[model samples]
Target: MQSQHIVNAYDQELRKLHSYIAEMGGQAEQQLREAMQAIVTRDSDLAGKVVREDGLLDELERKVEAQTIRLLALRQPVACDLREVITALKAASNLERIGDFAANVAKRSLALQQMPEIGLTRSLGPLGQTAGEMLNAVVQAYLDDDVDGALRVRDRDEDLDRAYTALFRELLTYMMETPQRITACTHLLFAAKNLERIGDHATNIAEAVCFRIRGSLPEEERQKGDETSFAVVSPGILGDGPTR
Candidate 1:
């Protein structure tokens, strides 16, 4: 009877840990969406709010870390139970990084607000939308423990990379066309890069989900779709470059 009581207590702790992860996942998704909204609307106040919210994410990460350590020390979980705890630790870390990236996008929005609006913002819209969708999908995969769904989510990261590569080329073209646009263009480029990184972190979460389900990480190379190096240039515009 004492052993059964101990087992039930351990199970209860694991369930609480899972619940915390779900809460953190929901907040991460909200942060990504609101960050993109702040950029599209050029709302500094909204952007500031996103930045401030990072503190909550940080606090949540710390909570997950402490809980994980407590479980490792007290429960000494093994096999699948061990994997569940470890994966939760890893997923929380990835989610924390994703939150940081969203805050970075918000910071970039402030810089972009100082300059004239450019057409590159259209490209950002699609890129941010794709990344946000990937994040939502990966979170769902983690929640459902669907290994096939996690694999599919991992594959979708290539779409975000392609969108980011295209946006990079378009922004470079804008900067080269007008020297005065360099400052704003540079900030926008950083913002787009942050969105791309968020997609990468989402892929990381998908991998964590796979680990939780299979007890091992994927052994094969991740299929990548980034093609930034071969960006096409306009005719007779090869000599153009952004001026500092």
Candidate 2:
């Protein structure tokens, strides 16, 4: 009877964590849009809002982590219960990191507001759209426990990475061709870099979904690792060149 009670509590806690993760994910998605909008309109107020919301995401992460740990300890969960606990852990961690990235983008938004406009914002629109879709897909995957859908998102991250690389080259081209555009272009590069990382984290959550379902990582890791070109891009200097 005690074990059964613990199991019920564990299930309840998992439900709570699921809702929390969704809520946090929603905030992050909105933050991404708002950060972009801030850049669009040069709205310091919008940037300030995103920065303030980061704190809420950080606090919610603590809540989710505490509950997940308690479930792990009291339930001695195995099988599905174990998967829930671990997935919640991974999801919470990634979501919190997403919040930080949002704040970073927001910081850039504020900086960009202070600088002259380069009319380069249209280039980022598609990148933001793709990332937003990836975020939505990962959330749905977690909710539906749809491993295939999650895997699809995992695979699609390569597209975002490629888009980012193209954007990096374009920004470099702009900076090299027009010296006056350097400051705004550099800030735009960092903002886009943050958005790219947001997609990567979403993909990380998708991988965690695989881990949750299969109790181990799937073949995607090997396939993703096989790519040799990112190797050419040094990890040094943010691999997109200096943040300056």
Candidate 3:
């Protein structure tokens, strides 16, 4: 009977962790959508909603932190349960950062609305879509402990990088060709840059998930110029990637 009680308690704790991660993931996803929409439509009201919800992200972070402490204190989880807790700790942090990125996008959007438009303004919207979609894959990967799926998430990071680079170059061209648009273009530049960093954070979470599963860091996913001299990285660390 005592053993059964322990099992039930453990299950409940695990469910709580799952619920928190999911809640944060849902919020981040919504932020990305709304932030992009706010910028695209210049809807300050939508921007306001995104700004207001930043607190929710902070709240979720605290909830996850408290839960991790409880798990460490009372449950003393071993093996898979332990791994889940640790992954939850890291994944929640990533989700929180993603939320901030969304808010940053909204803030930039607010500034952008005050300026005249330029051609390159449309670029970050699709990039946000790509990043948000990858995030969905990441949340699922964490839920199911799917390392393969996580690797796929890493793969998409390359596409996001390419998109950002293209957008950056195009915006640079605009600034060079028509110096009058430089002010709006610079703001747009910052927005695109933030979105690009958000994609990096998503990839970072995916890498951490890979690490938690396979017990090693996957450095190969770090791109070519990435000077991290670690073998366990790449798909090998996650047990899947370019080589495998």
RMSD (Cα, Å) for all candidates, in order, is 3.2, 5.1, 8.9
Pairs that collide, model 2: none
Tell me the RMSD of model 1 versus the true structure: 3.2
lDDT values for all models: 0.83, 0.79, 0.79
TM per prediction: 0.91, 0.87, 0.87
Best first by TM-score, ranked:
1, 3, 2
Residue pairs whose backbone atoms clash in candidate 1: none
Q: Show the lowest summed lDDT stretch of 10 residues, model 2.
A: 220-229
Q: List the residue pairs that clash in candidate 3.
A: 217-232, 217-233, 218-233, 218-234, 219-233, 219-234, 220-234, 235-240
Candidate 3 accuracy as lDDT: 0.79
Off by over 4 Å in 2: 1-4, 222-244
Question: lDDT by residue for model 3 over 138-208, one digit each (tens)?
Answer: 98888888888898888888788788776765666666567787888888877887777777877877887
- The candidate 1 region of ten consecutive residues with least summed lDDT is 235-244
Tell me the deviation in Å of residue 19 in model 3.
Answer: 0.7
TM-score of 3: 0.87
